[model samples]
Target chain A: MLNEKIICAGFGGQGVMLMGQLISYAGMLEGKEVSWLPSYGPEMRGGTANCSVMVSERPIGSPVISDDATTAIIMNLPSLDKFEVDVATGGNIIINSSLIERKTKRDDLKAYYVPANDIAVELGNARVANMIMLGAYLELTKVVSVESVMTALKKIFGESKAHLMKINEDALAKGSESIKAQ
Target chain B: MAKVLMKGNEAIGAAAIKAGCRYFFGYPITPQNELPEYMSREMPKVGGVFLQAESEIAAINMVYGAAGAGARVMTSSSSPGIALKQEGITYIAGAELPCVIVNIVRGGPGLGGIQPSQSDYNQVTRGGGNGDYKLLVYAPANLQEMVDLMQEAFDAADFYRNPVMMVGDGMIGQMMEPIEFKDSVSRFDLPEKDWATTGTKGQRKPNIINSLALDPAELEKHNHKLQKKYDAMKENEVRYETYNMENAEVVIVAYGTTSRIVRNAINDLKEQSINVGLIRPITLWPFPEKAFDEVPAACKSLLSVEMSMGQMVDDIKIASNGRWPVSFYGRVGGMIPTPEAVMGKVKELIGGEK
Candidate 1:
């Protein structure tokens, strides 16, 4: 019985929406009911962007994560500032320590500070930072496999952008190792 | 085809194209902009025409033009844009043209913020245009239902030779969910387009497409005839769903995105030993008035939940016919009511009882 309400947030260019989409797409591949809702309108243009991703075994009802009952994948400082309190007291918060300096303000949460940006830069592409954060999230929760995510990535990027897959995979590996090493 | 992950706005375009609607005209608007954008990209692949008109009014009139020519056509917009097209919508309705109008609703009294809101309920259901007219409206709850209804809307429009509306909030337009396009099963016996102005080649009488009647009594007769189609739609096209409806204490009535939220509330309440039933209307117009008859006499009361300030409450009250004292719970101006908020409302109403 897998039901995870995930809020993935960061600056607009940080691929936050893509992270949410990948989780949802991977969940669907694993035969789970999933939904992804992106934050649209004015804020999405080089501003803070976020998305709510829900993966469940049963039929999904509301696509909203109003109570923030499950997990938070925060990539930037403002994202952490905004969504840190939104995560449930006993829930999980996977922070990108590369961009965000502060720790979780609440002590009850299981927080993992992964250097997603640093890892992505080391992998030679800062854009894959989101996948690093996603890797950390998957490692922390095991909601969906990194393999399913790779399949989702291939399908999303299609055959046109096939060249970028290697870096993304490396970022996902580094992200997973970041949390496991802790 | 297997289920694919697609956004709600993109799904609308795909569904319309699947339904044999080859012509689309729409203006750019937030939340719903993806719909037109998708059409622009995909319509050409299917040998369809996607035209971004200069304005929303222009787009709807183009729909009217294409519909009068007997072509399956569609146009879409958000709240403020939908308002701009009301006059053309009325013209299409008065002419008895078959076209689909999709309003991916945004919060508004005027040019309001682009967020999910069902504030267009009254504007859509109560005839936003002038005169006595009704557009067959479908309010789909999820991405799957959204595509399903988009396909059905074209059929309904042609079947009744009237404009059919598919209204979903920004939630339905912005969310991405797994969806498989199903073969459409139309509920109406589609009549021929004999009344279309397709240039008869002098083979018969010219079919004049006009909504004008200078004679007072003549226009009255036309209005009366149009009323029959609306009545037939009520008789044949009503769609709704019920969940946990048997002998429940608090019965809820909701539709579209709000209905999904209510479902969560019902499931949560069931764990606490509170029996809650839900009646979700798929068709906003025709009102699903008969669904209220299914409520058990053992039920305590009815609650109408919406993303608006209770526009649908009037219809629920009329449908319930004073059988139960109906109370309304709502969050307006782009604020979506959460399941917890709805639970509190239901418990409040339940607490007052007994």
Candidate 2:
């Protein structure tokens, strides 16, 4: 853990919360202190959803508030509208360009708009857009290694989803490669 | 040696595992649902038992059952749900069964708002259930203490042969905090037991954990024994924190989250040249009256701030012994008073007319 707090947000069913959990789980796998907190209650249904994942080398005091977020992942316009202001100065924002039309306007912050949905679709799974976005985050933020993320994916999906793991991995590679291009 | 950032609920769940607790029974309630949800997934991995009971009542009873088995058993709930567990809690105490209960308190007189509140201080410290029984209540202020106290609660429960409670408000449960687990302080060396109802095949006799002493004499003796435990707890376990009180004129007494808020109030009071300090009770039941006794002669009054309508204020008054005038300020339900709001009261007491 390196005191990195990422707030992942998007509309419901976009796997916004799942993306956050994966990052948290990955941090945990790396023996880092990590917390994942999802927005609560009925708002989880058809409303905008957000989850906060904080990874630190030290013990975290509060998972919810961070003026030091090193990275943020926004899947849609609603997410960008909601959390773009809170991204720390100099933090990176990984945006899904397919949905969020307006760009982040911060001079101090770095923004990369990846067509995550398009890439996920090209990989034959729109649901994996969250993974692609996470891949973009991992690449741009260098929060975790691709190998570590693959290990986490294996643990999370387990032996049963072994087949779908390849496509997800491919999508993640594409996202990473795109970030390298940028 | 490694640290993991985790929700307060998740931290407690993980701590329970580290503490050698193998049985968990609980019902889901706001601000604390993550505890059970995390246990549901993690318990199986550790070969532990996690059951989502039908309600708070049943959850506590399941705790009773597992505790009687002489295994480390635990349960958790929010305010209203904890209220429902009161009856079973009393029974657990009366039976002297060792177990740990966690109250991730939310604001409530009824189905209060899901936001965190320290309103449950009195109920937890004074025995949330009925009877003369007492719980070794450990009130943790942050996530690190949350994990540490969970382990303490289990050890204390077994040590005293009574139920112990870990009391924390919504903030401690929901806040993300950095915490570390040390192997030295993490594991337990609890006594080996033949009291568990594992199997009767080669057992000397069946062990039954029951509070129903049909004979009046036996019941009275049992009650007396429990009283001795409570008395001993009062003497040995009262926990508190005193801040900037060497020459303080006003003593602000608070507990749990309210105490943290009062710390801010004290800072603001100091900036105005008001000599004020704080005495925060970390263990609400064994209310740390000892610290209050050390209040400087210049202290003319004590203030009690809570999230409930002065529930803890009543205790402060009793502890003060009418020495200094005790005052009360509070916010009810799920509404937490801002530090500014508490400062207003502090100013009125310390700066304005007493």
On TM-score, the candidate that comes out on top is: 1
Model 1 sits at an interface RMSD, in angstroms, of 0.7
Report per-candidate TM-score of chain A alone. 0.96, 0.93
Model 1 TM-score on a 0 to 1 scale: 0.98
Tell me, by lDDT, which candidate is best.
Answer: 1
CAPRI-style class, candidate 2: incorrect
The true-versus-predicted C-alpha distance at residue A127 of model 1, in Å, is 1.4
RMSD of each: 1.3, 5.6
Q: Which candidate number would show the highest DockQ if scored against the true structure?
A: 1
Count clashes in each candidate, considering only residues at least 3 apart in sequence or on different chains: 0, 16
* TM values, all candidates: 0.98, 0.74
Candidate 1: C-alpha lDDT: 0.91
List candidate 1 segments past 4 Å from native.
Answer: B352-354
What does the i-RMS of model 2 come to? 5.2
Give the range where candidate 1 chain B is weakest over 10 consecutive residues by summed lDDT.
B345-354
